[model samples]
Target: MKKAWIIWLASTLLLAAALHVAFMFAYPYILMNAAMDRLSANGERENVWTHAPRMTETARLIVRPSPDLAYSSCVYDLSDGPVQISVQPWGDYMSLSLFGANTDNYFTLNDRRMPESGAIVILRTADQAITDEQRAAAFEVVDSPSARGIALVRRLAPSPERFAEAEAARVQEECRALNAE
Candidate 1:
């Protein structure tokens, strides 16, 4: 009888311990599954950050010295290819960027001339046929051996005016393309 009681008590304790462990593991999973199900049920909602619709981020143009003309001109581009703009991820505004290609050295807009507080550096669309004057006046020299890009910071969000339907569609299309791949 005494042996039977000890065994029974031990079994009860073991069962209780197992139940505790099981609850610890299963409770969160159930909660997460339910949460995900709820979110999926409401997946049709659309907003600015929603993934289903398209969005455009920004448009960049390349600037280069023009062979025929004496000034640099920006060739407007639709950004059909993947373009990467590199900038330090700190601060409220963009100070430097590596225009079209990463191999192109990073340029700081405030290269030698100081920019007023809110001036934006614009690069032309094409890589060739830019005039020296356009290169000098239209685009800011972000990086040079001379003074530039020292205080330039990064801007994660552009001005509201920069957002457009075409840009949003491109972003959405890119996301869809990436998801398909």
Candidate 2:
């Protein structure tokens, strides 16, 4: 009876360990889902960038957001069609990152990678093939695995005072849904 009780206890511990591991893995998914929901509620519908206020001691949208950087985000729904992003690299440090529904960052580009045209146009193609017109444009095309996602534009501000400059730069950026034609 002693040996049987020990075995049962071990089995229970193992099951609990497995369950904890599973929850650890699922935690990010749950958090991302909640964040997406909040973003949809707060952000402009779709394909329009919404600049977030500068991070402060009271600000809590992103976990531990840095005051040294400014953020702008756009929720994307590519089920109907692909989306295009146009950015003017203005700051000393700037980056654009694409995050899928699962919170996985699939693509990122920084100021160093900015095109020579003084602007960068990125096309996130849906699961389907791109149109001939999209091929004709001077845009960087990338096939996206997920149709619903978020586009984040981050810019480094040298000081809290510079946040406005970064915001100004990002406000000029454009996130637009491409026409099916």
Candidate 3:
């Protein structure tokens, strides 16, 4: 009876371990897909920035969104080619962050680190090639572990008045296919 009970306990632990590992691997992908779907629900195309209104109590598009920050997001799909992202600085604090499909934040650039002209980044898949022209351009090139990911911009807007300035800065932000032109 003692041996049988020990075996049962071991089996239960193994099953629990397997389940935990599975959930860890799957949750991020599931969450990211849902976020993408919600972001594009309005017939918005990929590689285009969608500006979100100031965060209110009803805002639920993102988990734990900051009420003091304005957000703009782009669901990037790089299967066809590279995408170009431009962010204009606004307020005292602004940041651009890139997240992989698995919810890993692989890149982040803040306004303090950005040039006075703003930030221009080219995001491409690992297999994609960068042309000589792109390499020579002033923009920085980054590699995406997955073809699909999210680019998010956050600008500090502590008040309703500052939120309007954040919105104006978001208007100058751009996310588009590099080859579109």
The lDDT values for all models are 0.30, 0.76, 0.89
By lDDT, the better pick of 2 and 3 is 3
* lDDT (Cα) of model 2: 0.76
TM-score preference between candidates 2 and 3, better one = 3
Candidates 1 and 2 compared: the better one by lDDT is 2
Q: Count the backbone clashes (under 3 Å) in each candidate.
A: 22, 0, 0
lDDT of 1 by residue, 17-53 (tens): 9999999877755553343233233333111121211
TM-score result, candidate 1:
0.28
Candidate 3 lDDT, 11-72, residue by residue in tens: 99999999999999999999998888788674366899999999999999988999999899
What is the C-alpha lDDT profile of model 2 across 1-181, one tens digit per residue?
A: 9999999999999999999999988887788767766766744467778788877889867787877788888888777777878777764888888888778998888888877544545556555566677666735776666777788888888586688777777777888877644
lDDT of 1 at 130: 36
User: Which residues of candidate 2, in runs, are more than 4 Å off?
Assistant: 1-22, 42-44, 118-126
Which candidate, 1 or 2, has the higher TM-score? Answer: 2
Write down the worst ten-residue block by lDDT for model 3. 36-45
Instruction: Judging by TM-score against the true structure, name the best candidate.
Output: 3
- Arrange candidates, best lDDT first: 3, 2, 1
Error of 2 at 53 (Å): 1.5
Candidates in descending TM-score order = 3, 2, 1
